[model samples]
Target: MSSPPPLPERVSAVATLDDPVRRSLYELVSQSPVPLGRDAAASTLGLSRSTTAFHLDRLAEVGLLAVEFRRLSGKTGPGAGRPAKLYSRADGEICISVPARQYDLAGELMAAAISESGQSGEPVLDTLARVAAHAGRAIGAASADLSSALTANGFEPRAEDDGGIVLGNCPFHRLAETHTAVVCSLNYQLLCGIADGAGDAAHTIVADPDAGECCVRAVPVPQIPQ
Candidate 1:
C-alpha cells in the first residue's frame, strides 16, 4: 500500500499527443513512477480501454513511446495475461539538441544582417560583434517553431544583454563532433546572410564561415591573397 517513487523531471522530454485523451495519457505517464500498463494509463487518463490502446499505439508510432513485456506476478489466467504490455519512453533513441530550421536559416539571416551593416571598421572582433548583434535579433525574436527547431537540432542559443547569442545547448557538437561541416556551413551561411541584410558593403559573410568554436568568428582581415 505504498506509493511509487517520483518520476524524473521532464528533461529534454518530447510530448507527441494530438488528442486530448492521448495527451492526458502522456502527461500522466510522464509523471508516473512505475511504468504504466494500458489499463493504468487508461484509468488515470479517464479513457476507455480501446481508446487508451489507440493512443498508446499512436505514441509508439511516432517514436516517442515503447512497449515492454513484464511477467505478471499474481495473475492466475493463462500465459500470465500475455506478459503485460507497458508503455514508456523509447530507449536509445537520440533527440537532436538543436533543430533543423535554425540549421537552414539562422546562419543565413545572421550573415545578411552583418553584411548589411556599413562602417564595420577594421579588427575582426568589431565586425563579429556587429554580426552577432544582427544575428541576435533574429535569434531572440524567432517564433516557437524556429526556437524548437533551434533547440531540438543542436544550437540552443541564449541572448546576452551585451548583444550576443550564447550557445545555450549544442546538440550538433554533441552528436556530430567529428564532422560539423553541414552545421558549420549552415551557420556560416546564416551569419553571412545577416551581414548581407545589415549592408556590410566591403566585407562578405563567407569571410568567417563555420570555424571551430561557438559564435561565428569574423572573416579574417581581407587581404590580397598572393
Candidate 2:
C-alpha cells in the first residue's frame, strides 16, 4: 500500500479547507453520490463558475479532491464538445493529530493479526508481532532509507552523537500508554523488521522506553573481529 503523505504536507492540505468557500465546495463534492462538474457545483453553492473552478482546482492540487473529465450530456463524439472537468473527494485518507498518532496503522496491524490468528490457530499477540513486522518490512523496502522510512511512519528519528537513533515521537503513543507491553513489543519488532528490510544491519533495535518518546531505540550493532 502507498504511504500517507508526511505530516506537514497533510496538515497543509487540510489547512486549505480553513477557507469557508473551499470547505463548502469540498463538502458538496464529497457528499454527492456522483462527481460534480464546475457548473453543477457553482449552481449548488451559489458561486460563480470561475470561482468554483478555482477552489475545486486548488483542492485537487493539494490532493484533497480528485478531478476527472467526462461528457455530462451523455452524447457521442460527433458534437460532444470538450469533456467537463468533474470533482470528487480523493480516495486517500487525511488524518491529522497534534502529536501525530497512527491509530489507523495500529488498527490495521491488530486486524491483520486477528485474521491471521484465526486462520492459523496461533496466539493473537504472536500474530500481531509477525504482521506488524511484515508491515514494517514493506514500509522499509519502499522507503529510500531508514530515517526516511521512520519519518514517513511518524517515528521522528533523530541521530545521536554516539551513532544511535532516537525516536522523538511515538506513532502509537496513546495505545502504548494503555497497553505498554503489547504496544512496545509491537514497536520493537516493527523497527527490527524495518532494519532488516532497509538492509541496515549496522543498527539494532532495543526497547528503552522513556518519557515523551518512542519505546524503541536503534543502537549501532557491535562488530566482531574478522
Candidate 3:
C-alpha cells in the first residue's frame, strides 16, 4: 500500500533509567494525559514537593521525561520565590499497562496468522506472500501508532542502523520485572506482524521469544494459553 511511511530505516527503544526516585517520576509522567508539574505529581504520589522535584529532574537527566516551563503561580508575581517546576511523563512516555487489551490482543495476531496459513495451496509462496503481506500491513500500522502510544506509556522508539530496532528507554523495566512473559509476548506479536511469513520462500515464523532484540522478527508466542 503506497509504500508506507518510508519504513523508518530503523527504530529504537528508550534509554535505560535506573533509580527509584527517577523511576517513580517516570511512573507519574506516564499517568496523566497532559504534562504535570512536580508539585501536582508530588500531591498525587504523596511525596514532598522538593522530593518530587528532585526525582523529576533526575528522570529528565536520563531522557525519560518531557519537561516544559510554566508559570506555576501568576498571582505571586516575580516578587515571590523561584517559580515552581513542572513534571510529567514526556509526551510519548511508555507505561506498564494492566492488561490494557482485553482477552490478549496478541491472540488476534496468531489467529490471523493461523487462519491465513491453515489452507491448501499448490505453491506455498503465494500463500506465504499473502500471509506475510497481511501481517506486515497490520504491523506497519501498529508500529506507526505504537511509536506515539508507547511514548505516552513511558518509552521512546529510536532508530538503529542495525537491521532492526532497539529501546533507547524503558521506564517500566522495574514495574514489569514480574511479567516478562506477557511483555515478551507483546514484543513477539509486534514481530509477527513484522516478519510474518519470512524465510527463503519456504515461509517460516520465528519461534524464539527474545529474538526481536535482533532484526529478524523471530519472537514466538505460545499457542495462546488455551
Candidate 4:
C-alpha cells in the first residue's frame, strides 16, 4: 500500500479547487458515472473547449483528477484518429488539518491489528502494539533520517539542546485523548520501532505525556556497563 501525501502537499492540492471553474469541473467529472472528455465537459458547462481543457489539466497537475486517453467511439485502429483525453477523480483520500490529525492512520493500524488478532488468536492490544511498531519501523527505514521520518508521519519532532527529541504534535491526538492508556502504549511502541528501524540505538522512547504534546518522548539511551 502507498502512503498518503504529506500534509502540505495535500493542503496545496485541495487549495487548487478554490477556483470556481476548476471546482465545477472537478465536481462534474467526479459525480459523473464515467470519465468525461474535455469536449463533453465544455459543452455541459457552456464553456469553450480551450477554457475547459486548461482547467481540467490544471486539476490533474495538482493530483485532484486522473487522466486517461481513450477513443470514445467503439472502433479499432484502422482510422480511429487520436485518442480523447478523459478526466476523472483521482484515487486516494486528501485530508488537511491545522494541527494535523491522522485518524485514518490510527484506524488503519487498528484494523490491521484486529485482523491479525483474529487470525493468530492473540490479544487485540498486543496485536495493535506489534502492528503499530511495524508501521513505524517502515516509516523510519524509508526516510532519509529520524527527523524526516517523524515529520512525514506528522509527529512534528523538535531537537533539544541535550540531543534529545520532543514531539510537538501527536498524529493520533484525538484518539489518545479519549483512550489514554491504549493509545499511549501504542504511541510508545511505534516510536521504539521507529528508533529500531532508523538504526538509532542512542535514543530510548519513553511515555512522558504532557498537555498539547505527544504522549511519548525520545531521550538518550542509558549506558550499560559491561
Candidate 5:
C-alpha cells in the first residue's frame, strides 16, 4: 500500500501512538480519571521504567499527553523526595481536515445557537447573532489582519470604492447558492466572525448580493443605519 501523505499537527500528535508500547501507555493514561505516574504505567504495561519514561516524554512533546508533577507520598519538603511525573490526556481540540472545510464548525455553531434559543426562549436569529459574534471574537483574537485572514479562508476580499471591502469569492459558494436563506445567514455570521476576529469592529457585513459575486459585503459601520 502507498504511504499516506503527511498528517497535520493535531493528527501527527495522535499518530505518535502507533508504537505498541506508546499506544498501550496512552490508553492506560487516558482511561484513568487521575493522571498516571511513570512507575504505575511501567508496572501496568510490564515495561522497564526507562522505556516507559522515554515514550511518555515523547507523547508529551507531541502534545498528546499533558504532564504534571506531584508527590504520590503526599509529603512535602526535602524528605518527600522529588515529585513524580504524571501523565494525562491533553486538553483542547484536535481536528484535521484535508481540504480545510469548516462544515463541522458551522454545524457546531448552528447547533449551539439553536439549543441556546430553545432553552432561553429567545429568537433563533438572536441566538445565532450572539453565537456568530462570539465566533467572530475568537477569530479576531487569533489575528489582527482581517484581509489576510479572509484571504486565507478563501473569501477573496477586494477593496471597495467607498473605503469598504467586497468579497470576490464565497468560501461557501455552493451552499449559499442552494440554501440561500439558511446558508446566507450562516455566511453573514462567518463574515461577522472574520471581522470580529480581525478586531475590525468598524466594519460589518451587509447582504448586498450582486451577479456572480459573494452575497455579503463589508461596509463601514457608520453606513449601516441603527
Candidate 6:
C-alpha cells in the first residue's frame, strides 16, 4: 500500500512543539535577533550537541523553524570549517484547533469591526454585528453540514425530536460566561452567518440559552410577513 498523505501544515507544525526540547529551542530561536546555531542552543539549554541537532532538524522538517547553513565565524573558505547550521522562527503562522472552534476567526471579525468603527466614526457595536453576521454567513455557506460542522467546531450539536438542534458544548464557554451580552450576541450572529453561509437559509438560529449549554439553537427558518 502507499504511504499516507502528510498531515496539514498547521497540524504538523503544532505537533512539533509538543516535544519539550523542541519547544524550548523554538522559543529561544524565536526570541533571538540572530538565528541560533545548534552549538549555542545546546550549550545554553544544557543539552548534548547531538540531541539539539536532532530536535532542531525535527522542527525544521515541520517548517516551524527556518534553517540556513552559514559560517558564524568571520572567515570564509575550506579552512573555515563546515558552515554552521542556524535555526530561526519560520515566516509561517501555525494555529490548530482540534475540535475546530475558531477563536481566531471570531477575533478577526471583532478586530475588523473595532478598526473600521474607529476610522469611520460608526458605533462599535453596530459595526461589530454587521461584520460578525457577514463572517458567519460566509462560514456557514462553506461548511459541510450543520451537524458535522458543529461537532467539528466542538459545538456538540444534538438532534432534537422537534427537528431542532441542541448544542451540548459551548465552544466559547469561558468568554460567554464573563462577557455574556457581547459574546452571546456574537455567537448568535455567527450561527446565523453559518446558516446563511451553508446556503441553508431555511434554518434559523435562535438564542435559547440553557444552564450549561450553548446559548443558541438551530431551528427551521420562520416565515416572514408578505
* Clash totals, every prediction: 47, 0, 27, 0, 3, 8
Q: List the residue pairs that clash in candidate 5.
A: 136-193, 139-197, 140-197
Candidate 1 residue 130 C-alpha distance from true site, Å: 28
lDDT of 1 by residue, 1-226 (tens): 0111111212223445556776787777767777788888777667799988888887776666777878647666665666778888666343332222233233443354456554454444345454544554354344233333234334444544543344554333432355455445445544454445434343333423233345353332355879
Between candidates 3 and 4, name the one with more favorable lDDT: 4
Sort all candidates by TM-score, best to worst.
Answer: 4, 2, 6, 5, 1, 3
Give per-residue CA lDDT, model 4, range 138-185, as digits (tens). Answer: 877877777777887788899887878999999888898899898888
The per-model lDDT (C-alpha) reads 0.51, 0.89, 0.47, 0.86, 0.76, 0.78
Ranking by lDDT: 2, 4, 6, 5, 1, 3
Query: Per the 3 Å backbone cut-off, how many clashing residue pairs does candidate 5 have?
Result: 3
After best superposition, candidate 1 residue 77: deviation in angstroms? 11
On the 0 to 100 scale, the lDDT of residue 28 in model 5 is 93
In candidate 6, what are the lDDT values of residues 1-226, reduced to their tens digit?
0111223766777878988988999999999999999999999999999999999999999888899999888789779988899999998666655444556666777899999999999999888888888876665655677665566556778887777788888777777778889888888887787777677655678898872388998886667889
The TM-scores, one per candidate, come to: 0.38, 0.93, 0.32, 0.94, 0.68, 0.71
Show the lowest summed lDDT stretch of 10 residues, model 2.
203-212
- Superposed by TM-score, candidate 6 places the C-alpha of residue 139 at a distance from the truth, in angstroms, of 2.4
Against the true structure, candidate 4 has what lDDT?
0.86
Residue 147's lDDT in candidate 2: 87
lDDT of 2 by residue, 54-126 (tens): 9999999999999899998899778888899999999988999877788998888899999999999999999
- Could you give candidate 5's per-residue lDDT for residues 100-190 as a string of tens digits? 4455566677899999999999998788777866775566556557787666555678887676888777756666667778767877876
RMSD of each: 16.4, 1.7, 13.9, 1.8, 7.1, 6.3
Query: Is 2 or 3 the stronger prediction by TM-score?
Result: 2
The superposed Cα distance between candidate 1 and the true structure at residue 139, in angstroms, equals 26
**lDDT digits (tens) for residues 1-226 of candidate 3:** 1121221211111333455666666776777787788777888878998887877776676556767776666656567667656666654433233223212233443454456566653343344444445654455455434344333323344544542334444333432356564444444444344443222222233434343222223212233465
